[model samples]
Target: MSVELTPGLILILGALPVPLLWGRVRSIYLLALPVLAFALMLDTPNGVFGQLELFGLQLTTARVDGLSRFFGYAFVVAALLGAIYALHLKDTVQHVAGLVYAGSALGAVFAGDLLTLFLFWELISLASVFLIWASRTPQAYRAGMRYLVVQIGSGLLLLLGLLLHFHETGSLAFGHIGLESPGGVLIFFAFGIKCAFPLLHNWLQDAYPEGTVTGTVLLSAFTTKVAVYALARGYAGTELLVPIGAVMTAFPIFYAVIENDLRRVLAYSLNNQLGFMVVGIGIGTELAMNGAVAHAFADIVFKALLFMAMGAVLFRVGTVKGSELGGLYKSMPWTTGFCIVGAASISAFPLFSGFVTKSMVMSAAMEQDRFWVWIVLLFASAGVFHHAGIKIPYFAFFGHDSGKRCREAPLNMLIAMGLAAALCIGIGSLPEFFYALLPFQSEYHPYSPDHVTAQVQLLFWSALAFAILMRTGIYPPELLSTNLDFDWFYRRLGRSAAGAVGRFAARIWQAFAGAAAAQTSRIVEKLGSHYGSGGIPARMTQTSSMVFWTTVLLAAYLLLSYF
Candidate 1:
């Protein structure tokens, strides 16, 4: 295969002509970009391309390798699924945004240098927020703004970290940035923020639920997964991520159980899923990294399947709130079944996508003798069954009938959901295929007796617990209200502090302005007195001030040039 050009550019440049095409041409253009990009990614040989010296530092814009090829497949698959899902929409802006967002992610995955990574880092952040804005509601607008701030803030950290790294190491390479220096630490948190690390995760919950239905499904696929890739690429073997990932896997389940918004619940679920991958990356073994990459791939498919199902409900019934939804199985039975499949896959039921992938991470943890972390992961596994596996389907489909009836999801949405569901089952049932695609060879068999029995027992126990809790009326009821997460620290407290700073700055500015006005008045009076008809050369001085400053600037420039 010829490596003629950078593959990420296919989507990036292909998106430029989107809005110009009319009717079916635009649709074909949108759908073809992902396919072309995926083909290019598959065809490109393993080597660095687009190397250049910028300011005496080498930059590699395209680095095609095994790891990058894996993520490239993920990005293009996501975009293709998203494109098929969005085929009916006439919104070229949204299509353009999706393409640019996907392309930027691809670019980042293949980036061989820190500066190149940062370039696509900012672009992905900028391009993705439009998915939120496409919702076109005041809430979506505000949430999109907040999402952008957090995302761009991550990009800023990356830029500063890269600059400091260049200064410290005199290299721009983007690999193995261990957290032994200030720059590396900044870069870690930068990836951490995008990866939805515990304190930095509220953006996912706050904004994903607020995005357009299709937009949310697409949103589910990128960003955080990219962060996971970045972590695996640069921070592997960094021991701190082990505990961090453990905390991530465990905490979000509690929030998921309580979250009334189904999509927000999924958002929490996403954070939990990321924790498993992060743990694998931190372990930094071949099997563990394979687990992380494999889980990421399966996760994108099944998670997006779940989101697409809920998005169907959102599109048809105008709500995905647990309080407002029930007995959807009667109307949207296909969506109900798809949602169940996704729920099962995410819950790691035997023969589901997650079952094949998630176990590798936990096994890797056990291999590293991370006994407590493995215990936490075990507990998290059960908790996911309770919240995501059971609660999601039970509340949304089988709870008390909410008396809301609507048409099924549109045809395009169904096809998209079906395709994603098929992939989830295909990957789960045929683990050998995906295992071969992993960055390392693995002999981890998920269907071994101990593995299947343990998973089945875990599911049974978790289901029993949920049943008892519900029967005893101890379970929390879904209500029409928002739950606060870590974002409160900033959204409430930070906003107040910012308001205070703005007021203080305004007062200072007003004082300075008044004083300046007074000083100007006196100066004008003095000048008027001097520049009166009998005064000496004051009028000429006013006219000559501009010329004088220009000549002074010229003289300074000449002196610097001479020096």
Candidate 2:
């Protein structure tokens, strides 16, 4: 197959000339690229294409299976939505980077082998860093560098694992890569890193909030979703993911609660939501996998919607810090409504996107008789409602008035948010359309009496708890202070350790130089005393003495040469 015909390649190659175009034409082109790519993807028949022989091994460049097609659709829609969101921007650099990053993610989703996946995987890091750097702030620059390093590290681990897997199994086909070998373990960690697993997740929170408003929306959409898809494709049914997913879902709630930056809160929320998909994938059943994919698809829209709302706030108000924002609904009513929609969706409100999808994972856990996992997930569900569902909109739009007013978000941004908000409600109210796109056929329903009652009760109680905490002054106030997270090991503690090591090394070098200087001085004084004008050699004025010295020197030279 021609490489240009590939769905991802279209967006990538199409983005190169965006700078040459101007104004409305550029916007149309930018939006059309993703739509065109999506059309091509839809037209491409299922099964493998773009086969090639490399080093006597066959490589499949494109695999349009049910799984890949589902993720591909999600990526394309995200790209289109992101393009619409960013249409108000004039920065061609961000434009190019966003498109290429989206295309790279699509490429990875369609990749048929580990080698092919690695190519697009590294490209994703390379292209996406530009989104962070497009912010052109000192913070964004540093954050982008860190994000690049972590992403590249993931690629390196994937490369190493694939090499080992190829050696052990003589194949690099990306299938159920269980952790039964060293290679499989490495690959699992690679996917985990991209998935923002536990301690490895600070990059998302650190770099995402620092991106350009539009850039962050794109960032929120692609990278982690690709990781979730990869895990679903390769590591589903792995028992360990159950516990790992539980931790992923549960731990972020604490940090998000105290986080002053609303965007960072969403970043943490993104991690929490990923945990649900991870749990579904871990179950490895048809219904479970369906739940995972359904949730992933739903999440991309609502998460992007949340990011877009925050981005609009940042674009107009100059900051998204919870301490610095309040009563925004008075000015940005559209943005406020969209943000609330996103919050409700993420919180699993009865008529929202998360309600339909997140329950699938929880139901899957319950069906498997995983009592502890179910409990943890339930706790996480309530916790997310407290932080993301209630806290985000409450603080940004209705909390203590910051006495700041701003114009509404741009029309383009509002349209993008409206589209995303509609998708969230649509998926929730009419889940059949969404569920039909899943990889597997499942009869699981999302609107059961017990399910609705339990979810509503959970949300109601969680909201009530937040209300009491606020009224009683028990909730952590959003203050202008740095909240320490796992990144402290590198950002603070790690920097301090590095400084200490550097200072110690400098002292050691100083001592060694001092000792060497003293030894050299002593040797110099001795040589000066012996070879000075008043020394023995200077006193040896007689010809016989000189000849005797010359003969001795000649003899020594001859003896050393002979040896």
Candidate 3:
């Protein structure tokens, strides 16, 4: 490849001329850009590119390696699929934002230096929020703003970390930044915020569901995974991720169970899925890292598949609320089929994409004798299958009919769903295909007898419990209510706290102003008596007052001499 050519930059630059094109030419150009990027990525040899000196420091703009290549492939694939899904629209801004967002993420993943990574990282945050704002609703606009603040805050943390890191290490290379120093800790949390680590996670759940139907597909694909890649690259085997990952896997499943919005349910499920990858990265073995990368790969395809199916429903019926949607299968059978495939894939059902990948993390946990953590992961798995697999489909496609009929998804949407569905099956049926793209080599098999049997039993019992609860009418019915998450603190208390702070500040300013005004009024009153037209200074301008003052001064001087 030419020295001037960067796989990600090509896509970023390719977006520049999109507004100038018209009709078929533009659509073709949009579709070809990602494909062209994929070609460029494939052509990138395993070496550095665009190395330069900046402020007397070596900056690597491009670093093509096994890990970067895998993520690059995933990012472009998602971009291609998302572009095709969005092809029916004539909105240039969404199209351009999608390309730029994907390109920026790709660039960050391949960055060899912290500076290069930070630049792309900030660009990605700016670019992706446009996808959220593309919905053009007050809610979407608000969510996009919230999303931008959190994302930009994360970028700021990264900048601070990088500056301190450069000072401490005298190098800006982005590699093996364990949380042993102040700077590394800052960088870790920066990545952690993006990775949706527990309480810091509300931004993903908030912003993604508000995205435009097509935009959510793009939103779902890149941001968190790039953070995951960063973790895998920097903080592997840090030990802290063990409990963090366990909690991530466990807590979100409960929130998912009660979520009213199907898209939000998927958001929680997305959190649950990341837990497995985090665990694998914590394990930090060859097999474990492979598991993390492999699971991330499958997660993107399946999650995009789920998001696409939900996006299709949103496009057709105008809402993805579980309470509003039911019996969609009768109107949109193909989309229903695609949604189920994604549901199964995410649930880690036998012969699904998730089965081959998630188990590696759990298995790695067991190998390290983390038996209790393994147990928690097991329960989380069962919980995931229940909510994401059963609830999403049962509510959206097969529940009580809501007496609504709509046309099938548009052809382009259908094609995109079909493509993602195909990937879901392809990776599940042949795990080796996805496994080949992992960062490390391992001999873990996902289909052993014990593994299959244990998974089956866990799923069976979970399904049985779900049925019993439903039969007894004890399961929580879908309600038109927003359940509070960590965002509640911000949306409610944080806003209140902010208001209180503002009010207190205002009162302090008012009190200060009042005292100053009172003092000034006192001064003005004294000055007015002394210097007003009828007062002494005003009268002293006359000849009689001047002579009286001069005579008084001479008398006082003569009295002092006599004394």
Candidate 4:
């Protein structure tokens, strides 16, 4: 097939130098790059752009199918918002890294083949790490290292799985996979790790809160969303994902409720949202897939909006812990209001983005006769409101009157948040615009009486329970302690276990080396006895030569008698 370069790729490549030369150009390049990329993405056709041969594999880098187009569109919007949110930062390193990170993610989603996806997957990892490191604190450095390790590790698994898959299937195309094959399972887990599936989810909570305020906004948009896209692409309809998604939905609320760090709470909330998409993927019908796609697009907007709000808090207050924050509405009313919209949207409140998109996933579950899954999802949706919707804004802005009189977020930050907030309401109010972007036709209506009434009942009751609990002093207050998560396995258990084994092996090696040395000394002494000048063998050889003549005659006589 003939290769044609899309405007998206061209704009992304052109953006590479903006950060490096940012100082010379006074950061105009930093601001312009994302806008240009967004425009380019909007211009690209919704079809495959180019195909090429690399390493004997057919690699297609820009395939703009329906599913990919949805994600790519979201990513470009995310890049634009994130750039605006991060406009206050003067650091060129972060500016460049963020642009590259966004571009690579768009590239990955649009990739037609596994090879191109894997390449961009690794590129996203490489470019995104700088955001964390830009914080320039010891904690940020440590967290960034861990984040890079996990991300790179995930990429390696993806690469391995892709290679094995290509070898077995004789195709490098990215598409649906079954658990029956090792390659498929490998790819699933690889995506799962990024998806923050159940126990593999701690890296996000650990790393995201540790990044710069601007970094957190960018961080929120890319990694897990990309993972969701991959799962939707390769593992949709895999039955195992149903329960995984269910657990993902239910478990994070407990942590988010009690967590001190606001960004970390959002991280857990992110996991919960991903669970909804995972379930939609497992259902695998056109409506369910559309729901997943629609939810993902909506999620990118609202979730980024939420992060942008919290990032603004962190940016101005110099901290984002719920414990350290309170009563910010007095000073930053606009920020607070924007945050409430985000919280409401995430809570699936009526006439918000979450209300429109998340209902599709739940409806899809019910349609598939997944009664129990639907119930669990219902509980999760309520829990989402309890934690993300109520808890984030309540603690950050209203719980206690924190005496902080800080200024509102920078103009760029406000513009970014306002843009995201607008999109959140826009998508929610006009569901058709989002529905049209879905990969499949949407036969399910979100505005039906049954859906609306059920959702209202669930959300209102959840809210009532939260209020009663809080009023009666039953709800847990946010504390300044780190909650144990999946990272504990690597951070505590894995590290301790590896250290113990290492020490044990070192001791055994030391003893073995000492014993070998002693034995070698004995062997050298025995050799010396036979070969040294003072030894019996040396003297015997010298003396034997003089007696050789006499001994030869006696030996000859004895031999003659014997004959």
Top candidate when judged by lDDT against the true structure? 2
Tens digit per residue, CA lDDT, model 4, 242-291: 89999999999888888999999999999899999999998888878888
lDDT-wise, the better of 2 and 3 is: 2
Candidate 3 residue-wise lDDT, 1-563, digit = tens: 57544577877898999999978999899999999888888876888888889879899998888998998898998999999999999999999999999999999999999999999999999999999999999999999999999999999999999899989999999999998899999999999999999999999999999999988998899999999999999999989998999999999999999999999999999999999999889889888888888899889999999999999999999999999989989999999999999998998988888999888888888888999889999999999999999999889998889888999999998998899888888888888777877778788788889888988898889999999999899999998989999999988999999999999999999999999999999999988988877787687657887798899999999999998
Q: Rank the candidates by lDDT, best first.
A: 2, 3, 1, 4
* Model 1 Cα lDDT, one tens digit per residue, 367-416: 88889999999999999888899988988888889988888888888998
- lDDT of residue 493 for candidate 1: 94
lDDT of each: 0.90, 0.92, 0.91, 0.84
The window of 10 residues in a row where model 1 has the poorest summed lDDT is: 533-542
Distance (Å) between predicted and true CA of 369, model 3?
A: 1.8
What local lDDT score does residue 155 receive in model 3, on the 0 to 100 scale? 94
The candidate that wins on TM-score is 3
Task: Provide TM-scores for the models.
Answer: 0.91, 0.92, 0.94, 0.90
**Looking at model 2, how many pairs of residues clash?**
0
Off by over 4 Å in 4: 1-3, 6-12, 23-27, 519-563
What are the per-model C-alpha RMSD values against the true structure? 6.4, 3.7, 4.4, 5.3
What shift in Å separates residue 527 of candidate 1 from its native position after superposition?
8.0
User: Which pairs clash in model 3?
Assistant: none
Write candidate 2's Cα lDDT for 312-430 as tens digits.
99999999999999999999999999999999999999989999998889888888898999999999999999999998999999999889999999999999999999999999999
Score candidate 3 by lDDT. 0.91
Give model 4's clash tally.
0
